[model samples]
Target: MEQDVSAFLGRLAREVRPRSNQWAGLLMQRMRGELPELWEDEDLARVALSETVDHVTAFLDGLEHNRDVTRAELPPAALELARRFAEGGVPISTLLRAYRLGHVTLLELLQEEAARLTDDRQLTNDAILRLIATAFAYVDHGSEQVVTAYQEVRGRRMQRRLFLANEASRRIGTTLDTARTARELAEVGVDHFADLVTVDLLESLLRDGGPQPPTDAPLLRRIAQRSALDGSPDSPVGTGRSHTYPAESAPAEALATGRPTLLRVTTPDAPAPSTPDAPAPPAPPGPPDFGIHSVLLLPLHARGATLGLAQFARDRTASPFDDEDLLLAQEIAARAAVYIDNARRYTHEHTTALTLQRSLLPQGPVDQFAVETASRYLPSGSRAGVGGDWYDVISLSGARVALVVGDVVGRGLHAAATMGRLRTAVRAFADLDLMPDELLTHLDDVVIRLQKEEAREGAEISATCLYAVYDPATRLCSLASAGHVPPTVATPSAGSRAVDLPDLPIGPPLGLGGLPFETAQWELPEGSLLALHTDGLIQDRARDVGASLTLLSDTLAHASRSAMTPDEACERLLTRLLPERRVDDVALLVARTRALDPSHVATLHLPSDPAAVSGARRFTTETLTAWGLDELSFATELMVSELVTNAIRYGKPPVHLRLIFESTLTCEVFDTNSTAPHLRRARTFDEGGRGLLLVAQLAERWGTRHGREGKVIWAEQALAQPHLP
Candidate 1:
């Protein structure tokens, strides 16, 4: 071996001499940019390239004397580079082959330069063989130690990846909230497995009641991001804060195809391609100045559907990810995907329950005569407990109205369904003209029965309710509660005050219905504001109920001082009282009191006699005429005469006729009797039974409203649109 090497060295001692730039240029020209890890760091590549040229020039220069480089004579910079390549875990074969390309180029430069310098074919050929031999000797001597270091580095990295995978498995899928789950994924990946991590979800899946995105391509929104690069955007779009990934890009393709991928790095100068399915995403605040070079995008999937994707990115300074790293990343993504899918299912159910509740709620006032009303309902910020509160307005017999507000004890679809049932029962009881206290007792009974009928074995049905009945003429309000929050009354004289009935004990909440519910009477004067609400509007886990109610009262008082409409009052109250993030549903109703003007109302008392019927007719006609509702007086007078005559014949004493002129003309006759007059169609031959029938036909609507004093038989006529001069 020594003699053959000496002979080869003797041939090169005469002719092989390479210039620095000549060989370096040749080496670079021969390379096709295929180096993965080394090419990533341009500074390192430049340093390595320059050192290689120097080492070759110096070694060839040394070979003229001794023809070989021992361990002592080896270039320090080249030896240091070999150690770096090993520590960096570069494939020994690729590195050796890259160096061989440089060797081939340097040898070619030596042959060409030598021949150009002197045209001796024998010497040039001899120098070419000698330089070729020198190339083989250099590679053999240099890489002998690097290959061992590289294998050691590769083995250590494998162990580190296994440790990382175990660490990630224990950390991910611990939470069922989708955003939190995504955040966990990003947090675990950053600084450990990758330099930057991002988790993006399909846009449609984030919305309530949103439909499924198209299978071809779906838009994504970044939910969580973490970055190791300084001031670099965690996402591919927007500011360094967070944003969506570009369409037709790595992350989007991963999600759209439900596939994992290692994305190709995009150059800043390349025009981004656009497709119909994947429209290009917006450019970010910074230029495409991201440090990310290697990206691993793994789709987050469970139940055969893609929830989103987890992206792990490494900067140019980091090593390129291999197949094993990609596998570990995919495992982490799979674990987090389970929790995300669970959260999505919970969201879908919560939305459906809320939708069902909203669909069941009464939109606006059904009873326009009693009050000018407005209402607001707000769901929890988390949207988990949406269906527990409700409000309603029901029109009663004498243009009186019933206002209702209630809340079920628990939440979800069952609570919403129960709220609907209780609301329906309130309306039914309101139609019967039941007193507020009586109505609550019946509602309590209904709820008890509902629980028994539904047989919710483990779950019990219970709720709180506020029922109020208002009489416009009397300007009286009778309110009753089933362990509910007392209402606040904001009158012109008194800014706002809770109608706290000191002596009135609130009955047990519905479902525990043995005790009788008591009614508290307070005259809510004309133009007064009544605010009724559920506990959610006033109370939260962090606040005291009394303190919340006090705040609510002050809020309403402030709103009332502004002379706001009922709707405006509700909005103002909500703005002030509702917390930034509410944990429960809120139901609120604000009604302004309305009363009939004395001038619009006329009344006459009468003894038990047939002649009083004519007097009742005269009173109705004159009252309608004076109010400019004379067109309706003919029908009103006829209905009144029939009602009064019926009361006289049925033998009730101290009867009275009352007339009210408003949007509609109404005539009411009060009798000492408790019997309610029923309307029936009389047979064609029966003239005797047609008086009540004639009253029903003449009046647009008629009904009896029972009062503590007596039963009121009232008839109504829709007034003419225009009044004649």
Candidate 2:
């Protein structure tokens, strides 16, 4: 029958795949191939059946769910179980009768088989008994180790859980949705479960990483307990009497009881228990196995919230775990609390930052300027995108206005504060009636002082500023830059051109001194638009400022020239010009010159429009008022008349009149004259030659330039003040 069953088993194995040597060997050995002929006799069949049962149990032990045992090592005893099953299985009574013989009891036989399948180190019976009873079986038996393996694992797990919970609580929009308290509890449970056993109790409990723990008190505690031990209620490391327990029991007991318990046990081999918290009394006289002793329990709670409790004990009649242990547990609880609170605080701060950022950005359009204005501000992405970028439109003295935009160095509150200061300074300077260049110079001084003060306080900051004044009446914009990108102009007639108002960055970035500065001026045409921006708009990975500028220029050229409103234009340009992420902050201002349409001609025709003569005097005063020069307009007319009279009489001219209107009035009379006009000293009595001298004295500036047509004599005069007579 045994041979028939063995053949059947081999045939079954072949159905799966032809049996390999390992399987073949197991089958051959099961057929009593390795046993003596004497033991294989008919009467020994009962013993064989009994041994077959034992082998079946061992085979089951060797079949681990995970990587616990190797198939190469299935015992010869296990093959016999397979053969017995293949034949007629043995009865329970038959196995018991065999066990009653000198062979090991079922428990001992199973333990031996377990040891073999698990590949555990071989040990004597006494050692095996001690191992099943105490956790020391898992720990190295060093002479000086204080806490048992169980105690150490518990402490470390508790600490780890608290930490993980705290982190989850702090983040905004966290992966865990539960309340901080509950989440923290859950975190503790999950970490501990993962740390202790093959069974993933903690992960299973948090399947889907559940939102913070439920407020249901008992349920939360159960969850915590389930995580602490494989859902067992027994103590993990210590218990009453010298009887031993499994290594996964200490936290399980604390979790199940919903209360903390201290455990103390005196094994037969160690010293006696002493006063609580004291070292265990000296070793008792006996073999070395009897010295185990005291234990202590402490619960963790904080801010009226209870976490879980813990239990700890010594192994060799050492001092009982005491207040020190409790105190440490309490410390761990406090640390856990702090971790949770910090996590929440971080979440709150992040949310607040986003809201403030949205609120602080400019909301609507600024009124009064004629240009189709647009602007873009980009903050650094790494930090909360908040920085000191600003733009403002302020109404000045006349129908005119001041447009300002600038960025401060750095980010956050400091940059914001600097931006505010510089903006206010620009308005104040503009109010003082200083021209753009002079206003920028004054601001440079202010920046320098600010930097010095900041440095003394161990804080460093630097900034750049650009100031512009727009006169609506004259349709001109005067600009001054302080180490800023020169504003670009896109004219209806001239595609796109950047103004050449280059200067060494103003006042050494508002800190360092001895910086030289110059101002550049350009004639703004009707319907011409200008864009002023910070370096952030152009910054890229090329590591070169020029490269960044080229990229910016190219982007601007390709940008859609849609007929959108000023705000929309700004939004579109910004959306298209900037990269998705920027390394620095950007602030930009766009303004266009309002269009101008002139009616009728005001002309002063002269007969014998001579190269050197004078009909210009009568023409000057009368023609200017006709052009609405008024008190504001008188200065340009008088200077123009004088220069024209001088050129016609002394020098040469076809004798023509050219009027250029801007914030200041400019008048020139072109003559076929080759001599450059010079400002020279005239004696007080010199009348005729003194005409040009008086023109110089009365006008803001007077000069002569050889133009494409001829030598043109020009003079500039400030417009009359508003309400001026």
Candidate 3:
């Protein structure tokens, strides 16, 4: 009975072996009908046929030799097919079911072959039972091996996906720049996740933290794109190029619905659908073909808003995407979305703050007679946002110019606002012609008041200021600091040196009131360069303040020796002193000292008597005539007469009269009297106050300045042409 069954089984195997190719073809056709996903692609179909043929050949040989099929190695084709299935994300259950269907077909073929060999029912039944047992053992062993191969590849694939996700999370959004963050995501995708990756964001989101309005067609700007394959055209749109997506496109659909869309291309000629989770649509027909087989379009949605879209794609050389790939892509997109949103918000805030700070700063040339000035203001890098550093050239009375550089001790809108306020206050005090030390004292008080106001909001306000006044008449620069760096002065003859305030006290920063500020006076020569800068210019993390100061001094000395213009000197200093990535705001003000021409000024000592009034008026007329400012003679003489009379009447000892010719014709009277005359509306019968009132009415501008010796009552008349004769 064993011989008869074995002979029958051997006969069936010999008959099946020659027809194995035909049997494998029939088996693949049946499996394709039941398991469509496994045979979706031509490559997969080929792998399936090869695996089927190998299984058929091995089974027939085992039956013919009565070999122990259960202990045999799985066919190489079977193991390869299993790996392909795993990579393509086909389920193990589907593969197992296809094997079961193949087994059934094999049994039917075995019965037909057995019937062809013999007619005895018992012999046929016995041989069929033995053949069925052998087939079962073969299928069981092949299924176990195939499953092991699939599981090993699947496990490694999942681990790689996890690693990609972790890498994306760690590297994205390292800087608060929208474009950079997008590029980071693209790099991670190309390195580990996809062959081609692109990040596209709505124009509105990048411009102003606003959502794009809904439309039939969606537009997205491609901010970044990366491709793993060299010389491969990954995207039709280049970086920073904007293109509109059709309403039915996967990217548009994903953006509109704020969901992820997975697309698989089964055939080159098949009409792919644009719907989510459907087959991929053919890309626009043109040159530079993408040859893409799979794509995942995911909307970058975060914090209850959709910001943009991220696309991951694979070419024909790679496996088509599946459910597992879509899930992994979604995970990475979710993390990237948060980072992109953060960067977008930061960009908006930084832009707004910087704009406000720039607007509040002084614009255009200061055009002061005391000094020719140039300035530069630079905000900190993106990570720190905008900071509150300010510089100004304030035109003061008596041909004096006030150079100011200050820093608010924080960043963003609040600090900028504080800087604006402090700058306004300084200008106001400057107009009053207060001394540098006294002006800073008042500024300190203002800062204290600001701190008090903001304290209730749980915000503290602190600031530093350096105020310096340059007087052309005296060629003296009086400077005072409130916890700010000293200014550097470079001369034509002497090298650059930081102003020494050894005996003078550099008071505490503003907001700390009750400290008296001291002023230091330096007589800078004409053509000297004075540099007033915030601590940002001379304080860096990599270098000590002393070293930075020395560098600044050296650069300034070189600039001065080179005879560069104030503007050129400013550019040179900034280029040399500034770091590539600025961590703090920088404000630099460079001024070239200019002295009033001695030929334009006339000074005469006078006796404290009524006779001096006429002499002063005569001197004013002569000086105006000599300077070719005859047009202002009448007004200048009358104003000079009134000021000289007031000084003689209210004075004690010697008086002085001076006339200056420059932008305007000025007449000044100096006396021992310390009291300053005030402008008042004179009554009809009051002859006493009319003298000062007449002076004010005749002169374009009139004021009184007090000095250690006494007081100076001065008045200026407008000149048609301010040039010297």
To one decimal, what is the Cα RMSD in angstroms of model 3 from the true structure? 5.3
Worst 10 contiguous positions by lDDT, candidate 2: 195-204
Give candidate 2 regions above 4 Å deviation. Answer: 1-363, 376-378, 451-456, 496-507, 513-516, 541-548, 560-564, 596-725
Where does candidate 3 have its weakest 10-residue lDDT segment? 270-279
Clashes per model (N, Cα, C within 3 A) = 0, 31, 0
lDDT tens readout by residue for model 3, 1-725: 89988878888889778889999998888888887867868887898898888888888888898889998878898999899989888888987888889988988888888988889999999988887888888889989999999999999988988888888888887888789989998998887568889998887776667766545555567899998886554465668876667677666777788879897754544232232223345554423455667788888988898888888878734677789888988888888888888888778878888888999899898755888889999887748778889999997666778899999998888888888999999998886667889899999889889888888899999999999888888788888899988788888877555444345467899988888998888788899988999888876778888889889988888888899999999999998888887888889999999999889779989887788778877877778778777777887777777777777787767888888776766777888878778878877887688888788778787777665578778777666755532
Q: For residues 604-650, what per-residue lDDT tens digits would candidate 2 score against the true structure?
A: 43433453233465555565666577674445555765766666665
Better lDDT candidate (2, 3):
3
Clashes of 1: 0
Please give the lDDT score for candidate 1.
0.73
Ranking by lDDT: 3, 1, 2
Top of the candidates by TM-score = 3
- Order the candidate numbers by TM-score, best to worst: 3, 1, 2
Quantify all predictions' global Cα lDDT against the true fold.
Answer: 0.73, 0.48, 0.81
lDDT of 1 by residue, 336-420 (tens): 8877887777667777778888888986456366689999888887635565799988876665788889999887888988888
Could you report the Cα RMSD, in angstroms, for every candidate shown? Answer: 9.6, 20.9, 5.3
